[model samples]
Target: MLPYKNPELPVEDRVTDLLDRMTLPEKAALICHSRMTAGPIGDLPGDLFPSSEELISERGITHFAMMAVPDPVTMATWNNHVQDLAAATRLGIPVTLSSDPRHGWASNPATAHSGGGFSAGPEPIGLAATDDPDLVREFAAMASAELRAVGIRVAFHPMADLATEPRWARISGTFGEDADRAVRMIEAYIAGMQGGTGIGPDSVACMVKHFPGNGPQAGGEDPHFAYGRDAVYPGGMFEHHLRPFDAALAAGSAQVMTCYSIARGIGVREVGASFNRELLTGLLRGRFGFDGVVCTDFNVVTGMEIPGVVSLPPRDWGVEDLDDVAKTALVLNAGADQLGGESDPGLVLAAVSSGAVPAERIDEAVRRILRDKFRLGLFENPYVDVDAAAKLVGASRGRELGRRVQARSLVGLKSAAAPVAPARIYVENIDPVIAAGYGEIVSAPEDADLALVRLKAPYDKREGLLESAFHAGSLEFPAEEIDRLRTIAERVPLAVEVYLDRPAVLTPIAEFATVLAGGFGADDDLALDVLTGRAVPPGVLPFDLPRSQRAVEESRADVPFDTADPLYRCGHRCPRA
Candidate 1:
């Protein structure tokens, strides 16, 4: 290893000098870290988030990405930690803190800063439903302010994946099932988050994700967990998926993330795009000509080791069949700028020392990281106010837009006026305060004479996102919980609204309820409109809902739900007359 000497040099020189000094262990350490992993110096949880102090340290770690934390103040604390770390680090390198996209109040750890009270504003489906480009831009810009105010610089969001399947759990999180809509929203999303020029001292950078089309996963399963492998684009039909990434680059997406799922038979290891050359260099850099920071989707390397103990299907990609050293080699060769999750940087250093990877490659990655910090003005000034970080959260203009988007994205599946006799309504899982804004907010389903029964929740069961993440699949409802819903539906003409995340069967409610609606996210306004017969359902089934595990398996890969003899054909929206 070379000696470290260029202390006063520019970012580029310092990066080169720093790389020259680091041993393999230290370099590998830079690439891997657990989200919110509490190390000796910082205090955090084990959900793959990072502390601010860890970011600014001169310990040769520049890329700091955090996932799965769901709070704003906690997020603020995390950012403040980064700022302090930057100030205290020997090199004073302000950490480039990045998130998956917490635009809405969902505060999904993937996108938003982790912790309490962070708003999970609305799902991306809401933006596409509005079909208003200008509005989309406004929303993005608003969201940018919100993100920046909280001390985060980059957003790992605007998932450009075309939601072509109804069964895909990540669909509600995307723009929609259309490529064009996704592309347009990508532009708007990037513009909103990255465009505001220190306007009122707020503006978050954007990171367009799941590059080169992650929508084609054989089944609707997300690549994040196991079982969700094979993103087959059959004969380069993948052009549609690339559209959004192109548009995002043109619109100035500061950074781009790789997909964890496997792509067709090509990179069968389910290796993330972060380490895929076809995705990073061939497509993004070679074709699109994007010269920005390139980071991996979180914990991708470590994820390969996961055996996906969390995901349902026990599976293995072909890469695991190859030599372990070669596997990590492929990722580094693929052009990943920075490693993600709690990966060990040792893989990267070993690849370098053993001559599997060229020193130039590692240097290039470091350059990109430095370039981003430079652009962010971190080199000039890398600190943020702590008090301000807390104040700015949930105060951005994008929050309302999130609600509107959620309302607009809703698609009424089943609505019936059959034997109907009521002007008002009420429900659980919904705050009457939020409900009243859209329509009647009642406290009693029985008193209303007609019940618009909507399951306003993430899953049909009450398992939280964190719990479900670990559970993977095999998710089921307890008998006590099922009994309560059964009794209520049987007594009233229930308008059963269901949130279609994974394949949630509502045979119980269907037995007694009058209506069933999918895609019930946070806001109930849009669902409310559909129930009241104000908004006609235009949503098509993104994927087929398998009645049984056997059906889900037997279904075709491209179009999983065959219309010939499927439980629910694609585009099967039961509209009101």
Candidate 2:
């Protein structure tokens, strides 16, 4: 057997030998990670681009970011089949599987998959609300075990970008606005996911994201569309945003992903971080000393067009003038080891043939890729036991822990004079059976002693297909919704539970409700537990609740704790009974 295949050999020796044996096509395959949807073993969904056999056997692609798997056993079987395909190649290199966050209730296909067949609980923002590093560590550790049980080696998560801009659509995914608190959360997160030994088959390698920081989008616009492309640093607080990533690196995160936002007014060239050599190579790789795999966010090389529905031309933010080959060369030279969501490796081979990219640059990228796989022990054992997957994934103990964390992470803004176990209760968007356990369920608000209402944070409501999906635009509630809440409050004492996907203006609702609680992707049962004093609420505000929309507009996009006259300040919560 070759030295590269020998488990006993040093990791450096194995990586070096594998790099020498790899051809340009093979090397390109290692550096390109494609998107896949989970389904039956050896069979892929129709929506997925490029067939499974074509990518693995013909293109030599190995890394896959899987989404929408129905169950644990099927996911494990699919992984085994994908690995079997890679093993059939001439060199028999094993595949490394990755996944977006799938342990939460928020199921955005592009961002996070549904926690169906796995532990489902509050999102990361909820974890931040707890503000307990020990709890965050425990959550990540359990999540890591479940991910590895299903053959997922990489966790493309712990979105470390600070949620400074309250209107940004991705705020629900972050550790919140305070840099120091986010830094502590980052350390605990990496520790839990990687464990003490770090980056082994037993560990799930974490890809800490949006390097240099993705928060502070100008006017809270996302970088996904042309309208939301600018990231202005008016306060010159760019370094403050980098604190979480710095903390994550110190904790030994194995991978980092660059954001799509094109930065402006802060020193380096105003381009996408993925294409900016100074930011990716000089700042991150040079000053920060990040030698781990640096992957692009998604689809930087190819432009996407959905025809009348949603059209996103390529995300080559600074270099839109350049063609596809030039763009590919620029990304490689900028120090990106892998292209996320890109299926074709031939584009890279073409760039090398045109002399647009040096052959040595490919070697550097492939070396990092091979080293990560070797460190993960993928070559020794890539297949998972399909039967054991169901037993291990979302095991009873793990789910119970997730529930406890969910209960602990609920933040009560205002509590009623007494516990909310009224004789007659009217509930909206809550399980009727659960409410029955506390009081008699009634249909009319007038007859009920208390009215329980659940609502999502408000947004401006963009009309375009893709634009509307992202919760961008105004952060204030509409007049009609505000009126409705007022009417409900007038009829009966109200208990309002608002989902803090982003910081929202809640002055009107606060005025009416006898009790108000803020939740970040938390379940109704947890809210009930906190209200009835069955469990003590253990969460705090991860960010400030602006008094009004005017305050949010006045706050600088790049600065944290800048909002004035906040209704509820960061780290503030109603006292426990």
Candidate 3:
């Protein structure tokens, strides 16, 4: 047996043995984390990238980020097939599969996948609303087990970024704006996912992300687009944003993912976090002492274009003028171990050949990458039991816990005139069948005892295909929608529930609705349970609800709880009446 294949060998020894025998191409493949399609066993048509089989066999790629939310059985089978492909390679290096947050209701194809065949849980903000680190740990434990069942080893989440900017598109994914609370939640998350034994077979290594915080985007726009590339710190809260990452590193997080935004106003160069040596090597590695794998946010090396679906230029930010080879070299020299959402191994080879990138840097990155795979025990057994997957993934107990969490995470802002037991409920954006279980469903507000309305936090629609997925822009509801809501409230006593993906300007809704609440990610059933007297909403506001769009616009993006006279302060909750 090869020394690297020996189970009894030390992981470092195994990594060294493997590194010695690996060809330059194999090392290059290990450092590139690319996206892969998930569905049937065969490659689906209309795929813009190479197939999994082609990636592993031809390019020797081992790391993949799966975006699809297929059924557990199909996912397990596909994972097994991927393992089979990897096992046939010359070195038999097992594939490491990672995914964005998949146990939540939020389904942005660009960010998180839907909870298909997985236990449904509240978003990270909802977990923060609970303000229970133990419960956060419990959710993470459940998510970790489910992920491992379907052969996913890495979790691209527990986004430690503070939601300082209330209008940030990705606020729902964060643990809220409080640095101290975020620290507790992030530590618990890492402990739950990685487990007490650390990055072993039973663990799903947490890649605590958007390091140095991604929440302070200038004007609350995402860094995914050119217009939103700058992450400004006008409030001088740049160091404050690093608190959660400090806690994450202390908790033994296995990996870190950089943000796409170009950090400005700090001493570092105005470039994306992934290509900033002072941030990655100086701050994260040197000051914080985090030596784990640092993966860049997706598609930083090159732009992507899927015919008619999406067209995203490379999020190179300040370094867009650099060629692909130069970009690749800069990322490597910046101390990132992997290029996320990138598939071309030829670029790495080209960079090294042209002397733009040092061969020593490649070796160092390969060592870190190989070390993680070994620590994860993927080297010994990469394949999962197909039969166990169905039974283990999204089990009944897990789903029940999710439902309970969802109900508990609903934050009541106003409940003074909430209906205790209305006979007829007029519903909007709610399942009539689910409403029937609680009360008689009425079609019109005039005929009903009370109106139950569900709304999403306001966001102006963007035209770009990929850009639209991010819920950016204004927090105020449109004038027409507000007018319609006003009409309903006037007809009958109104109970309003808004999904707080981002903090909404709730002043208008609060003025009319007798009962108003905010939720992060809850199902119709769970929302109804809270609306009726069946469930008591114990959650508090994770972040402030701005009083108006003007206050939101006036507030500094880098500072938390900066909006003046917010409709509801952070941690505000209505007492049960």
Candidate 4:
């Protein structure tokens, strides 16, 4: 009944069966890219690994990252379907379903891999708050089980960057401020994610991220954009950043993701880490001895963000925005073994024909991709039970885990107005019944003795040309919101909670709103507890809120956050008595 083959054969044999007959185009498609892009799903109209599998069968792509994968059931169904498709091919090459770390409940975009609807688990800050490596690993192991259940063999997660300054909001996603803490927690996380027999065929492969550190984005901000461009360490604190990577490498992580955040005047991100030879082959593969697959961060390629006007539907074959071949060459030369986004294999095939990249290079990348597949034994026991999807994915255990992380990761920064928790609480946005438990929640800010306002603070650092060109012409809060806050402040002790991801310029809270509290990825009760003092507010300041734009512009890149000595410090905490 299986298309790929009977699950009994060794994965190597299965792969070899498929590998021998492929043409260059099929192979190029396999090794270069994977996606969750728009398209109908189902193994390439009955091809292995979804729509592309048939092409690979006709040609030679033994390795490819799986995409469009739904929840656990869909994941298993798709994976099994891929294996079946492989069996139908002469080679019956099995594919590995990889994921962004989908644990507790939050789907981290930071990954190309994930099982959707994951619990909103605790991030690095929460893990750090626990200060328990065992707990960290426990979360990892649980995540591993969830991933493994859905037939995901690889997990792209366990970010281990050291939180260097207050400006970096990404710190919430990492373990903590100290390098040692990050290293230790990462070790535990890997152990947990790897699951069971340590390093055996059944373990989930852990892909540690943003190698060589990406935490100290200049100005305590993310380098996702031009203004946040490149990581700089004039402090020479670069070595500290490398510690986690070293630990992960030493621990034998299955893969490493190159950071999109560029470092200094070094390397090229016009193509990103996939094209950074200094980063890929030189440092990770060579110096670190990382034999595993090295991949690029999402949509980092030159042509990925091309103008829509140039690209037409159904392969209309029109004039384009970027030269695909040149970008492909850069990726290959930079030692990238895979591609991200809507990269077509036609370009690689063209390159091969034109002698731009030797056929040997294609083979090199293809073989590596296949070899990893061989190593994972995907060829054998490829199809997972559609039922296993239900069993492991939405288990109550995962939800509990997420809830716990949400609790621990709650970082209580500043609270000026006295904490207030009336059993009957009123909120403008939350549901009433839901309010009854936290207190009788309300729909309007004006009615309650205590008003809880949820505000989303700034996160991404200055990037995009538009962003760089952005000038803060004035500091102003919304008049109505401010007026509302002032009114609420008058009626009752107001609790203004913000989903603070980055250090914000807290200009004049509208006098109406009183009692300010904020932290990254806040859970409702976590905010409530911090207000009621039911839970001690253990969150600390990861970045400082500057009072003015002039001070931000004058600051040096790579300098620690709070450089201007704003209103907060690293350890500033407001705990319940």
Query: What TM-score does structure 4 among the candidates reach?
Result: 0.77
Estimate, for each residue in 1-577, the C-alpha lDDT of model 4 and write its tens digit. Answer: 3422444665556455556666776677776545432123443332222345544455434344444456666666666655666667654556666666555323323333334645456555556655567777777777777767767787667777776554554655676565666777788888887753234456788767776677777665554444454577776666667888999877778777767666764433332455567778788778877766666655454432324322212110111234667656666766776765434677677767777788777776766666566566665566667786687676788778767766655555545544445655667544445556666665564556566666755443343443332222222245565666676677776766665444555555623344565555546666676655567665554445566545655555344452475555554555442
Residue 463 local lDDT, model 2: 79
Clashes of each: 44, 1, 0, 43
Candidate 2 lDDT over 1-577, as tens digits, reads 8999999999999999988998889998888888766677555444435667888999898998885677898889888888889999999999888988888767665677766488866788888888889988998899888888888999898888999888899888898988888888888988898894368877888899988788999889888777777888899998888889888888899999989989899888888988889999999999999898999988888865434445556777878898887888889989899988787888899889999889999999998888889888899999999888899788898888888778767888877664446888888989998878878989999998888888888988887666677888787899998898798888988888888889988888888888788888767788876655456667888999999888889999999988898999999887663
**Candidate 2 vs. true structure, TM-score:** 0.97
Error of 3 at 417 (Å): 4.4
Which sections of candidate 3 miss by over 4 Å? none
Residue-by-residue lDDT tens digits, candidate 3, 302-372: 97767666677899999989999999999999999999999899999999999988899999999999999
Q: What is the lDDT of residue 290 in candidate 2?
A: 88
Better of 2 and 4 by lDDT: 2
Between candidates 1 and 2, the lDDT winner: 2
Query: Candidate 1 — number of clashing residue pairs?
Result: 44
Candidate 1 segments whose C-alpha is farther than 4 A from its true place:
1-34, 37-58, 67-74, 105-115, 196-203, 233-236, 265-275, 303-316, 321-326, 396-398, 413-428, 431-448, 456-467, 470-492, 502-520, 524-577
For candidate 1, the lDDT comes to 0.57
Q: TM-scores for all candidates?
A: 0.75, 0.97, 0.98, 0.77
Error of 1 at 220 (Å): 2.6
Off by over 4 Å in 2: 42-48, 304-312, 532-534
**Stronger candidate by TM-score (1 vs 4):** 4
